[model samples]
Target chain A: MSDATEKEGRGVRAVETGLSLLGLFLDSDGPLSAADLALRSGLSKAQVHAYLVSLQRGNMVVRDPQTGRYAIGPFSLELGMSRLLTLDPQITASEEALKVARKLGQSISIAVWGRYGPVVTAVVQANDQLLNSAQPGTVYSVTGTATGRLFAALTNEAEAREIAKLQMAEVTPPRYVGACPPFDEIHEPLETVRRTGVSITYSFPQPGVTAISAPVYNFSDELELAVTMIGPAEEIDISLEGNHVAPLRALAATISRKLGFIGKASGA
Target chain B: MVKSPERQRGVQSVDMAIRLLEIVRKESQPMMLRDIAVSAGITSAQAHTYMSSLKKFGMIEQLGDAGRYALSDATLTFARHVIRNDATLNANINVARSLSAEIQEMVTVDCLVQEQPTVIFAVQGPRTPSLSLRPGTRSRIGNSAAARIFDAWSDTPEMNPNLSRIIRASGYAHAEGTPVPHLASLAAPVFREGALVASISVIGFPDAMAPEPERPVLRALLAAVSSLGGSSA
Candidate 1:
């Protein structure tokens, strides 16, 4: 390699070493001292300290005077907030939702947790005649909708109970093709969702309309949104192991991965 | 210019990279290639090499048609860990949120950063009108109650002996209608592990938040401070 290329190669290694030091903070339970970092990284204490001082000058890391341990600082906070600000889940999942809808010949809707309950933020119709109530900005009833049951099942128990009880008071029971359980008896359906990792509503909101929903998670493994496949009851299979259900689950996991989720096994 | 001790010990490439980052942060705006090179006292070609390295690391990026470089959100992953991993700051932020909700007044938590009191967390109370002291807002010693609380507890020569004594005796400071007319604030120092670490304050109208011992707000503020083991000092 030429002299210029050799110098550039060395510069890349330095940047990689600095970033690896910062990356170590992500794994640590709390603030770490230079000695702790040196142990974790296999670098000498002096080398770690020198790199840390440079990182500190950039406000990439901050050293506490009292404990002499280092933590992430303000500059990184601004960058992180900026990244969060630009995350439009609706936009991120729209193309994938549409692709899945085409593959399965079913309509799809994306739902996010709103103040009231699960609120539908976007929808992709498989065809013109796919009559469904999954409209943009429509708030799904926790005791009434498939997307609602998914959130009510997976969220913190206390919060899920509150949301379930709140919707029980606000919405009236919808007529079902089959004899549906009373609105107050929602525990069984929510339990099913928790066990199956998906929710199925069979022709409750509208006669001949059935929908199956699964959750999409963010980097933190928190339930960020729900992706639901909607269709006519006769055409859609609502069983957990049915042909359509597995694809829906796979699609949800794919979108979750795109959003930086890593907790779940890939393609599981 | 003399090299600081840190510069003497630090890696040359890492130092150059940080100097560029500091320039971007201080400018608070996207900068062109030549400008950054001139400020760092390096050639444009040399600046380009460092800038390329920073971009590859996701620390900085070029924006719009101008190709001016600025900090990127790539560092947010690291930032998230930084904010989440600090136990003391994290616990106090939770306290600030709950106390503001319970009292229906804007609550702010601040600590000394380079001797200036800087707000690290703030929750607006429902009852209080708008207050501008968001996170990262800074104040000098005499500007606000949080700043004064830090000054009172520290042994710096600029510390007022009488004010320090008063604050130490009461465990809080009351600022009534001085910083902003008709606005009042009551601040208490937060101590952890037997050392003064931060200050928490409630801000609102003077009538609702009077600076008196009998006032329920003062009692509540003291209660919140004690719950955190912050009243030890």
Candidate 2:
């Protein structure tokens, strides 16, 4: 290669190596050591160390003083939070979700169709007891959860079929086979949810938990977000005339209105 | 992509030092020189040279006399700079300034950072008392109103259950003579999507925050929190 080309190649290689080191944190359950990163990234320990020092200077990663292991730093969290704030749909939905959650005394979550499936972008728990119900950045299966099913129902036919195929591929043996119903069986329920603009499931995704999800539309009337209420099955009333459904739908409509949707669907 | 000649120019030792920092950051515990050297794929002598330079820059710090190394406050300082420029945080800072001016008391916006309640923004009123809290100050979670609000809203296992319950129920927390003697503070949680994003607080002498929850400063503080919480974008 030409001298300039070779220099360009080296520059790109350096950035690639640095990015690969950062990528290791994505799969790690906790902090990682240089040795751990070297093993995972196939970069020599010396190379990894060099990149890490640079990263630390930039505050992209931080090492615990007590433990030598390194993890994502405050700058990384700031970057993530900034991005989340910029997502108008998430911010709008979250505001409405917080109001509904406080009013109804039930946890609320906002999910958007993400690369893997329905990824929860924001969550507000009613109290300490429901702390573990859901959290931001959790990706749920499209066919197994209320938020996922709502997204599936709103998506195009080809994408919906792909999601169903992926969900079926994850099913195991005789027990799970029956547990995850056939695509044809779920299609009718999804159709009903699409017609009604809401989806409610009990003992799905997990037992002892109930979830109700309603679609939020943008100015163009396209489904952009799913507002969900999740809680313990015993405490969450999921019937049509129950306490949860009306308010849940109303909250969704409120969010849609905030997004500039002028549809006549009265959530009140 | 076309590379500028400047892109090719980089300090080799600086790169080596960064690599060491990354190694230390990745490790779960403080790392010994030998382990750091082995992980960095460098000799112990080479690693020692880079570690010494990193330590000089406060990028890495030695753990006691054990010869183990970990990151230092320099990383947090850099992180704080990023947070200081965040849009939502900046907007909240404006709110803090207005609230401080209205109440004639110190106002602050505290956010959870690395599981600790850290002051990200602060505005001192004209009549503010003698207190030294500034941006980046970490307050005690057990006793401070700002910290307690975060503890109450967070799901972290380290939170005090009883205090968290009270804060959750009341939507605010008040503390007297905590973090500092003779100081009183009231704080309200800012919720976004049902999660506690930050806490807005007003601080003053005990008398300024007296009469329990009926003080005007407290009302103004809650109003500021409400305004922040109601922001859709």
iRMSD per prediction, in order:
5.7, 16.0
Q: Estimate each model's TM-score.
A: 0.62, 0.40
Clashing pairs in 1: A80-B76, B191-B230
Which stretches of candidate 2 lie above 4 Å from their native place? A1-268, B1-19, B22-43, B48-77, B156-162, B230-233
Count of steric clashes across candidates, in order: 2, 30
Question: How displaced is residue B170 in candidate 2, in Å?
Answer: 2.1
DockQ of each: 0.27, 0.02
Model 1 chain B: weakest 10-residue lDDT segment is B73-82
Question: lDDT for model 1, on a 0 to 1 scale?
Answer: 0.74
lDDT for each residue of candidate 1 in A1-111, tens digit (9 for 90 to 100): 356556766875787788788878877767899989999999999889778877787677887778978887766765544444344556768878999999888899998
Q: Best TM-score goes to which candidate?
A: 1
TM-score of chain A of 1: 0.65
Candidate 1 per-residue lDDT, tens place, B104-217, comes to 777888776545676655665546564545555676666577877878877783556987888878888877773577788889988887688889988888886787877888
